[model samples]
Target: MKIQYFIPAMIYSLAFALQASANHPGSNLDDVMSEKETFFQAINEPDAPSFELINAQGELKKLADYEDKIVVLNFIFSNCAGVCPLHSARIADIQEKINSTPMKRLVQFISITTDPGNDVGSTLEEYGQTHGLDPINWEFLTKKADDPEDFTRKLAMEYGVKFQPEEAGQQMHGVVTFIIDRGSRFAAKFHGLKFKPINLILYVNGLSHQEKKQKQSFLVRWWEVIYYYFIH
Candidate 1:
């Protein structure tokens, strides 16, 4: 199994699991969230865009690093005196709620800086701290040492948002919190600052349980096949 093929394979397996579960379910969690959360937008896209950004400690981080955990991802620059701060605080609130429960271990919170040049060193670390983002399950990432100035900003665009830099050290962009399921499946987005924090939390909780349900469903099917062929 080459690394490149691994994600697609996981996506296929996940799709099978979801379809299998759909047959027995009362209502799909994705659908439930869509109805309950006015701002929740369900997406069935492929793997999210790849990135090779660096954290505050200068270690290289990629999308694959958190493949085992449901990723709560967003993009922001540290210097933004506008909606960026509010957006980050919203994420922090969501992180806090999730961390209080067992879901904390199953989720990963990622904040990528669109302006990596200024968001280096303590800047990255401080932004998280200032916004009450817990380090236990959250990370603020920036461009790597040799990355181009607009590297992360470009990556943001790949995710369907733009962070256009302005002369006053601000970037114009919308607030969207992305949810990537385990295995890098681009799952959903919680748009804007007005979404209920608990809605995002419940959605993440649903995603975490979905993986477990999928594995259980797979085992059940395997056993049925064995019984039909070898025992029955």
Candidate 2:
């Protein structure tokens, strides 16, 4: 994949301050902020929560099955007029770019609906079709009958987004696009619609070339080292 390399101002601004304080401690803020860093915020590397969900065809799907491929996950409801449409469009743009490259098969896209009641069968399929999301690697999903009414929304909460039903039948919620690394199981999140679509593509492109590392945190690294020498 061809990468468009440009640092976002806000992300670079915050990243410089944080990395400088954490790494150099006494470095000048201006100098620290000038240092280049990738903005895919490394978290505690939480295990991405997976649950039972159904696609537009009402077939059961599980997140764990995609362990061999990179997963780009988002939350949206078909009936939403606010951010969901724009969010879907942005994802569509990213998909078009990805499909042109070899990264296409390495990635999968999922958007779980907040309005499963309205988005079913053809309705769910049309949302993806309208957005030009390729069905081979993308799915617009909803909860099956056995799952709780709010099961999918509750799962979205695990990814750090909250949703509540508005009086007009729309939901008040935040937009987050998540990238889950294959096998390594650590998930990184890109928050909000303001982030560039190319930035996300660049990130996944990086992950595709990444040699899978087992533990990310310093503590976890040391613990594993000690176990290998002593316990093993």
- Scored by CA lDDT, what does every candidate get? 0.76, 0.67
| Residue pairs in clash, model 1 | none
lDDT of 1: 0.76
Residues forming the 10-long window of minimal summed lDDT in candidate 1: 18-27
Cα RMSD (angstroms) for every candidate in the order listed: 12.2, 12.1
lDDT of 2 at 205: 52
Q: How accurate locally is residue 194 in candidate 2, as Cα lDDT from 0 to 100?
A: 69
Tens digits of per-residue lDDT for model 2, 16-42 = 222211111111211211221233444
Best of the candidates, lDDT:
1
True lDDT of residue 141, candidate 1 = 95
lDDT of 1 by residue, 1-232 (tens): 7743553343334334442211112236667667667899988666878888889999989999998888999999989988999998889978876676656677899999999879998999988889999999999999988889999889998888898888889888988999998778888888888887756765665565433555545534543453344334
Please list the residue runs of candidate 2 whose C-alpha ends up more than 4 Å from where it truly belongs after superposition: 1-40, 44-46, 212-232
